[model samples]
Target: MTALAVRQIGPPRLTKGLESAGRLDWDAHRALHPHPRPLTTDQLIALCEAGSLHGRGGAAFPFARKVKATADSAVRRRKRTVVVVNGTEGEPGSAKDKTLLRGAPHLILDGAALAATALGSLEIIVAVTDPDAAASVQRAIAERGLGARARVVRLPERFITGEGGALVRGINGGRPIPPGRKSRASTRGVDGLPTLLSNAETYAQLAVLAGLGPHRYRKVGLPQEPGTVLLTVTGSARFPAVVETAAGAPLGHLLDLCGSRAGEGVLVGGYHGAWLKGEVATRTQVSRAGLAAAGGALGAGIVMPLGRGTCPLGECARVARYLAAESAGQCGPCRLGLPDLAGALTALASGQDAAAARDTVARAARMVTGRGACAHPDGTARFVLSAMDAFEDDIARHVADGGCGRPVLGVLPAATDARLSLEVDWSRCDGHGLCADVLRGTVRMDEYDYPVIPSEPIPARLEADARRAVAACPGLALRLVPRTAHDKPRPEPQRGR
Candidate 1:
């Protein structure tokens, strides 16, 4: 993680070039920050509107829109607003946020401060879980003596903890899971005051643009807007690193940097992303516009490797379960639906009935969707459902012949990781039937038996039932497995019958 000198500049930033992705310490951002008057909210909005800067965070929601939403607030008496820098990088496959937060903390801070100034905020919190990232940001804060106005907050290590809203919850000492309902962090956030939350890179980009102004910023990228974007190229790369390329840099140019050695197909945007069979150089453009052309998103700008060695269906099943378990469990569709959806994938991956699997998937999609409070459930469902569509051929093979030719490589996270294990304390088992009633997909009553448990993963629609199983467990044998890498399923003496 040492910073190596890349060629020239000002503030030190990290980049994964085609040649080398190692940390480089070139001073591209060391120039004096011009002490321009803090732009009025309208001026800031114009700067964003002129620059055409998409959200550096995956969502690409216009920064101008978020600013307009929060900055234009009409609350009679406003609570002191806080601006949150989300650096969780929760997606296991994405590393862009961590890279920016670790290497260019000051640039991010400068941008956040600019935003805070615009929003009438006095406090800025740079939140992250990665050790190196946290330390880097903290040191930058201390070195600049910006500690009073800007601070760094270390967070509990977990995947779901990175969700935008979840990160807000983490900051306030609440559980880091997303809530059952959607509330804009910019509206009702951080100590019940309207907070402006954005990914770390968004701030960095804002800083860069603030320093350069809209005209200079528009020089490099498309005329539709102007500016560059940073992306983390992973999967199969000769020398993968963070890249500072033109906004909507053609994937071809980036792939050229990758050269011949890249995994066949790719997963764009990270874990909460989509998988496709293609490369960047020839077919697709890399801009939000470009990615949209490819029917994909430039989410968090993670270019993951979809190596050919893994079975696509098995891979889908694996990640599906992880995504399901990663749910904040606040929304009904995501909590109940994801598990069921993931289960269907597991069943298909293991050679279950194809027709039944398809029907079950369709049903799960219908039941758990639109019922969630957050987009997590909806996004997870979209990912799984799209995967099924994307790799229908492999899925058919899993059903008709019981397997895809490729081995189930660990490219995707485990599908059954936390979902299959139903830990009910025998002593606590009152046989009250709540767990069974709630999670019939997992547990059921058998003749003279406490509960019949299925060893397989649950469906997405049944996620609520799983939670209810945990909540309703009379003996409190049921417990939720928080979303974390260490959550391994427990082994059992008796197997599912």
Candidate 2:
């Protein structure tokens, strides 16, 4: 694990006044952000509502509303509530969660305790993927004498494993995938109890908000979205960092602070976020509303600036392929459509019939939109579709001359293949035609009416259809199988030293 390096480009808020420092151990963290006035459940809710605090996760859900739902539900049902700190940063383009966990573990823990105490429960579960971060939390738990009341759970590194439902499922001793149906963790989660779940940054922000209250918290950020936000700025920047900036700070200013050059386009939010260029990127602020106003978002506080000299289409294709492979493989559209989009983009980037490739990618994106168990399909589509607009000129030149004359610099991050595949259980098969019918583009019927599946990875657009087919199949023959197929066999060991 890399050493946690953190700084505040602007004045620090959620960063506990740290401007240029490395990881803050529990002592350092407690010293910086000391425990302050504790709020009751209603008081905490009122403070969040007044400050208009939203989740720092990609969704940016309102913190007060979620807490209220959980608290109200628990009070009514007479059930013990739970507070889950989601430190699983699955987005390839993000390091803010890990940074927060490693740099200032106590801030998140304080927030977790604050939230848990407010919800009338002492149980706190922190789900984290990074071992280093998890260890930090565990150390802090012991130091604080939290014992079993607060625990750190090590999670898998899969892309969608950070999802709330998936985290709950894993905690409940099931595979870390979202349930087939739409189920909110706030109502039924963590052993069938009312749960309050949010990302690491959300908890840290809550801690900051709890200590500072509304009026003082309003000193830095926008009137609507007040307080500083932590952003992970990477890609083409001179110095990559998890920066803390005021909510309404200009996007251009943040880029400049990170030493980003002019002519570099930005992918705001994250992989599931939008790309922005020209005046839009410069004028847009860091707030959720501000980014949304500029056809972008502040999702999970991730900012990636694309260098001017790189092939934008190539970068898009690389990310698209990575996203395709990252699919949960439970939905038809995500399973089939993403690969199509990636292939089409790759073809276009490689100077193959650019016009046709563009059309195909666009159509594939449309087909997959809003057709997944989660927002993965829709978010992936948004990411790819927006690239077309942000790089329109490049598309024209590539289409006309079969190239842009620039090499792909691999500016965006791509995940290593997990060697995951879809599998069929013959014993569970009853010659059901539903898989083939729904996944018409991916699955075909065999001579005996059983599915004839391909060996290659399924396209993402077919994710929804696949999920439907699986759900509809009475025999439950189809399943998404993840394997260590990408791992190379170990070589024989050399003589010991």
Candidate 3:
């Protein structure tokens, strides 16, 4: 909610022709990017395919393929196609989308309008969780006289609420969680219409790609990833800014530009992304393929340098605990397994006979992978497992004598538990076993057939089932309660001298 100074680096395609003078208003944006070329569906798809444009969202899916699928589905179903610009920016430590939306709102609106027009749709929805971003977008829409074509909808600031299907469900007045079954928003989204949903940055890139075409757009970045990427550079850096860099820019170069020194490690992507050691960081490239080769990902365009002096293992444990709490509680493996993994990591961090705990963490990470309704469990597994490999020596030292003698600086960010958590009133409870049956992992039966919950906070994944159990409770015992502010972790400790 605070005002963040967003600065760019490299040639700056998406954020091109702008300076830190201030937010680029509608008139300035129109002047900079004059008369964007309007393209039909086929023309847009051809340009995207030629440029090999990919989603800036964590998945890195082929953008052209999504367009083709949505267009084809729309034609076949005789349904209107829709465009949803995702500005949820739910990934912690990532602020590029918000930066783009807030700084250059017109650019995002142009891209969304382009997509909607190309797909023969008249509707575009820009979903944002940040109040400032929403206000900026609304003002841009009004100024551009795009009131008929596009609208901005504010969403609850939660991690999972940003997901494509979950956002669609929320927009359509359903609970903001992915449906139990696997379904693409392209096939059914936003009032059962075929929808083309993508990250807000992706749409901004679309606007750029539309103007530049395939040739000029391919000039700066790699051939594989032929465009610039916006990265939110943070963690132990002298200057934390939203950086725009070419796709193939060396990871270490960005680190140096962000004021990172030698001996520092980098967490490529975001929390669910991998942590590469300093040596690996130098060799790593900013593109997806390059990062893949370096055992990392260009996820959500987040590049965080882990400076010297902090404990990588301790930081991993803290992030793991936060990830466990953010689970949508839709699947058993994620709802139960993540907390177990976090517990194991916590034991390891505290130096409490950690070898067994380390093994437990590893096994739990593997067990939870590919078992969730969404990619949350799988991505989280990758994050935890990668920490194990990246910090192998630290794990070894901790297991040998309990710890590596370093403090957790909390470099990674996570949302505090601000939502309502399920609560039980003892006077209203009548030892109903139904709550335990419906919410198996969350509600356990006590000796008297009453539900006994652990002191740990319940994850969002289990919230739906918890509500179901509450409704099933004949005694009207269960209710949702806001967690205490004290439950939040302390402010991040300062790193470096």
Worst 10-residue lDDT window, candidate 2: 488-497
| TM-score of model number 2 | 0.83
Candidate 2: list runs displaced more than 4 Å: 1-4, 17-20, 262-264, 417-497
Ranking by lDDT: 2, 3, 1
Off by over 4 Å in 3: 1-3, 262-264, 419-488, 491-497
Q: Encode model 3's per-residue lDDT on 5-115: one tens digit a residue.
A: 555656677776544725788778887885577789998899889888889988999999999999999999999988999999887787888888888988888888888
CA error at residue 329 for candidate 1, angstroms = 1.9
For model 2, how does the per-residue alpha-carbon lDDT over 31-102 read when each residue is reduced to its tens digit? 778695777989989989988889999898899999999998898888999999999898877888887787
* Candidate 1 ranges with C-alpha deviation above 4 Å: 1-37, 236-239, 259-264, 279-282, 413-497
RMSD of 3: 5.9
Worst 10 residues of 3 by lDDT: 488-497
Q: Give the TM-score of candidate 3.
A: 0.86
Q: For each candidate, what TM-score against the reference?
A: 0.78, 0.83, 0.86
